[model samples]
Target chain A: MSQILRREAIYALTGLVTVLMLLEYFFWPTAQPWAETIRTWAIIVFNISLGLGAIRLLMQQSMNVQKRRENWQYSAMLLSLFVVMLLTGFAGYFATGLQTSNGIYNWLFINIYTPLGATLYPITGFYIFSAAYRAFRARNVDAALMLIAGCFVMLKNAPVGEAIWIGFATIGNWFQFTGQIPGMRTFSIVGALGLIAYGFRALMGKERGFYAGGE
Target chain B: MWDVIGLWIGWLLMLMIYSYPLYKENPAFRTAEHMFIGVTLAISIITNFSNVMRMCVTPLMQGNILMIVPLVLGLMIFSMLIPEYQWVSRYPIGLLVGTGFGLGIRGTIKPNLQDAIIDTITAPTSGGAMAWFNFLYVAVGLICSIMYFMLTFEHKGPLQGPTRIGRLFIMVGLGGYFGNTVLFRFTMLTGRAQFFLQVLKLIPM
Candidate 1:
């Protein structure tokens, strides 16, 4: 019974939903509202799945603290923050606690969350710049062209390049946008074809790598 | 006063993150990283949980019978926590995957496939001889780039010339993307530097 649910039933449900959507998209215009509703249900389902990661993190951190693993203090700190954040978050769940300027949740988000998130890209920029030396090496014709293009872009951005020659910025703009449009268009078409192919495979039960196990 | 406090806190956090490269691995960075993780995960879980309450449970309570299906499906997902009933989660997963792919294909079909082809073939020709030349050039480039993706037929003999042209287009496209990425990183670094300078009173807002 369980085997049937996991294998055949799962695939059947997927195919039905996919067919419903595709039909709404192409054939059954009247099914638009139904399709949208189904899409909403799917989003809700995916969001619920999001909690699984937090559950896993809580479990792992709890174990680390219990076992007194190396740097277990850090694990304890994480667990505390996780629990505290959850409490603060839920405190604001039913009220104006999350968004109101006077609320603790909003305060924590601004001071902690916003700063932490914003720092990510700027910090990562350092490592990328360090790695850029190796990456920009002209090992082949493709590498050389890419390097030249990167240089032009950088030149266009910097005032020094324009001071040397005004055409540097113009050439860079042409290379970055006009030169890449046709190729980008072609890529988009190919990517869409691939997506349609994958959707077909799912409909045919050929794409079973997702949720095909546990049977 | 609150804004000043937030600014100081943000400046300190930014300093902690930026110090990582200078010190290799440090306590400050690890603390920040772990705290970020915990807070981020908490935020995500809480947001999703609230969404569930708003979208599913509340609707079911208010007499929307259809909400029960997703509610049940979502509850079943937690069964994966138990070993024996882990198989039960596959139903919701299947539904999610199906909906995702269906949406993906549906979304891409018109914009990426249909309109893309239409745009390429019906290129605007109002900008004189240069416009005509560009249109023809793009048409050829697009055809060649597409031919590069056709792997079933070998790119030898008759297919060699177009195949090479396709490769060049691919490289140029890749180069443009690479350049844009580097420029983005540069902007980000500069922004961080500016923040530091502002905090030090070396620059004005």
Candidate 2:
């Protein structure tokens, strides 16, 4: 297809999808069976995407290891654990008559993955502290506003300040409303709008990087 | 004994996984990241498929073959795997996008519009100074935030005042985000610490 034709095609398809979704949301069939069918299809599609993503992740890590990258060992460890987890999970599932309770999969997930995932974010506190010490300098207007807001919220959330000041909760609520809530909402709206636009572009085929050629 | 050993080993492994990044990137962390992603993806896929086959496809195949419309739609998604046949992928994409948008619009109205707005507006008239202040904040916050998205006109006119206030509200929001970030980081540290102490045998694991 020619460039202009491709762009037009992309726009048309994206618009169609958007309209259909809107229709489905508000005015689609109310029948339980049809709704369930859509839900099932959605689940299947989501799973296929998940499988594809895993394959891609493995490929990326293997490439890193082959190139002898700085963090290749992490990749190796990750792959090993992955295989171990998958085997245990599937085997345990079948062994226990498809029951998730009291299985190797559930055990590993609860004991290992959940803890590690939750912990990963927390462990970054050292970095955050270090980063804040260096970067939280109130040298400018915006930075100063940020510093003030951060300090207030931190104080309110922490148990120490509430003990010292009875009004900390009130102050925290005030700060949250006047400062954080509005700002985040606007930013989120902007983000959502951008995503919608890009989504439209992709649907229309105007965004084609995922495809083989630039076309 | 074996279960205990495995648990401890897992904990040690978790610590090493986080710690290795500090010293330098190594095969251990890479292996862990890849393995986690891969296994998580595989398990999720298998489970989801089993569920789908059981609930949707099996019943359809057994009784009403015409009920396999969605199954065909599901297959259309695989068109993405092909080069020239890729346009077929759009069929499924269209269905998904349309359905998601339609659902979101209907689902979002109550939470986003009526309850949040009406509740804020109807806060008690009689209260202590702090209570009155909070009520006002909620009312103002909702309005200012909504205004932040206005695009038709420049915020330079009467909106200049409210929009400036809106900007301040946004900064406050960002500050909350920063605080959350700090908390999140500490949580990560605690995870690593737990791994070291309980699993790695650095303390007990």
Candidate 3:
């Protein structure tokens, strides 16, 4: 009985929101005011919900510390840093009306957080090189073609390739414009159709994965 | 002076974090990883709170009663923490999903499907031989690629040819994408390397 009520609530809410949005799209003058209100509400709700992630993180890390688990010291460090950052942020916001630009917050962010974020993408460079060495082997006709095309495109992109042969750019551009765009467009269209179908299924309550435990 | 010192420290810490994975994962890497997650979450929470204050709280304080509806709806999300009333959380999820779908469908249909079809159909056929050839190539490629995704028909006999061509086009497209991605990653590495070199005064500007 409870499950049925939950499902019904989900359906009702979904249907209501979707219809409202559709009305906003089609009949702008009529639904504009209500739609704007709803949109603002959605944004507020979404932003508030973002803290749930932080809460979950705190819960897990605190558990690790409490249980004295292996690498619990790291968890301790994590929690301490989290508290310091959070406190500094709130304090800055209250004091200066800007949390991010506060001296301590700015220093920590620029020194620690920014560097950590920047390093993550570049680290993938080494991994991709390793993977390419294994994956780019020309074992068959299709593989050989792909390897040749990939090599051309890669060379065209690199400065050394331009120094070696200027024609690499021309060939690469031709491949991208003539070969890639059409294929990509078809994929995009297909994907969009899939999205629409999935949306409809969700609207009809045929897709219940959004419900916890898939109820 | 202090900012310069902080920048240098940042560069060194970044290098250490990145280099650890090349050898073997160690405690330093794990600590840094945890620190990153913690800092990120802290920043996210603060940012979200600030947004709520500006968008919802401020408006309500200014005598807007409508804000209460969303405040209540948003608060309902925390019900998930209580197992007995967890289902209440589904209301917000449903609304969000519905809004997302409605917006996405309305936005995607014209741009992804209609515009693409229109562009393909209106492709110029009355240029030089090369231009005409390019147009034909795009048209055929688009058709074949679209056909490849038609799961209703088995790729046998006459259907096999187009499907094969479609697969080849897809491979080429994916290869191009992969190459671009590799180049982008290399460029990022170069930027980091440049920063490190400059910080150490090893490279002249």
Candidate 4:
């Protein structure tokens, strides 16, 4: 009985929400406000869901520390920092009656968070160069053509490349303008169609892999 | 005063964390990794709490009783914590998925499909030699790339030629993407290097 109810609720909710959204798009006169409300509700629910992740993190880290697991000291450090950051953020908001943009919270974000986040992408630079050296070998016709194109584009971007030969910039521009844009557009259109088909399946509840008990 | 010091400290910490994988993994790297994850999660939680309070809680408290429906649905997600009630969480997940599909499908159909087709068909065809070449190139690229994706028909006889040409065009397209990615990474490296050099007084701003 419970299983049947659960399945029914899932199908009904999905169908109702999807139909409401389609109505809003196709027949905007009636369903506008309701569709807007549903969107707002989704956002609210998404915000609430963020706590689920924090809760999971807390539980796992606490367990690690309690059991004296390998690298438990790191887990303890994580928990300590987590609590400190959370407290500082909440205290800043409550004390100032403003968002986290002011006080100690902002300071922590600018100094610690922003710097740490920024380093992530730049670090990828080293990996890209390492990979290019290994992969960009001109062993065949196709690979040679691609390597030549990549080298031209890379040189055209760098100051030293232009200083070495002005023609590199001209050829690079020609390749990008004449070749890349149309190909990219074709790929984008195809990708978008795939997304639409996937979305349709999800709306119809045919894509049930996201559900708890789903295959 | 303190902000400048903090910025420098942050930069140093970032460099230290990033340098770890280059060398062997050690305790210092592990400690930094843990701190980074914990701090990031804490910030995320605080931001979400603020958004919920401002958007949902405040409005509901101010007499928007209809907001209760979504609030309850949001709360239903917590049912996943209890083994017996986990299936109930599917309701909200279903609603989210449906809403996302509806939003995405409507938005994608017009710009990605309709506009793209119109743009390709009506692209300027009459001009100088270079202009004509570009027009033909784009047209051929579009048609051949589209044909390459046609899975219904097997490539044989006359169709084999176009399919092979289409594959080459696709390869060229992929090559362009690879080149662009390399340029982006190089640019990022240059920016970070410039900052570090400035800090060390090796170069002027």
Q: Which candidate is the best by DockQ?
A: 3
lDDT, candidate 4, B45-119, per-residue tens = 888888888898889999999889788988888888888898878877877888887877788888988988887
Residue B155, model 3: lDDT of 90
lDDT of 1 at B12: 87
Off by over 4 Å in 2: A1-33, A58-119, A167-170, A176-179, A184-215, B64-67, B128-145, B155-159, B191-205
**Which digits, one per residue and each the tens of the lDDT, describe model 2 over residues B1-205?**
7667667756655755676656766756655555556556546755766666676677887996754766676666666667676666655565565455445555555655555556667767676887777677656865776676676778998988887776666666787789767766675676567656765466754
**Model 1: TM-score for chain B:** 0.88
Distance from true location, Cα of B32 in model 1, Å: 0.6
Candidate 3, residues A1-215: lDDT per residue as tens digits?
78667788678788778778877887665887877887888888888777777787799999999999988999999999888898999989999778976788878888889888887768989889989998788898778777777888887778777788889878887776776777788889999999999988888878888765467
Question: Relative to the true structure, how large is the alpha-carbon lDDT of every model?
Answer: 0.80, 0.63, 0.83, 0.79
Error of 1 at B175 (Å): 0.9
**DockQ of the candidate models in sequence:** 0.67, 0.36, 0.74, 0.65
Model 4: DockQ against the native? 0.65
Q: Give lDDT tens digits, candidate 1, residues A21-89.
A: 889988999999888888878878887888887887789999999999988888888888878877878
Ranking by lDDT: 3, 1, 4, 2
Which candidate number maximizes TM-score? 3
TM-score of model 2 vs. true structure: 0.75
Which candidate number maximizes lDDT? 3
In model 4 chain B, the worst 10-residue window by lDDT is B166-175
- Identify the superior model by DockQ, candidate 1 or candidate 3: 3
Q: Which stretches in model 3 have alpha-carbon errors above 4 Å?
A: A1-4, A27-29, B125-127
**Model 2 chain B weakest lDDT span, ten residues long:** B97-106
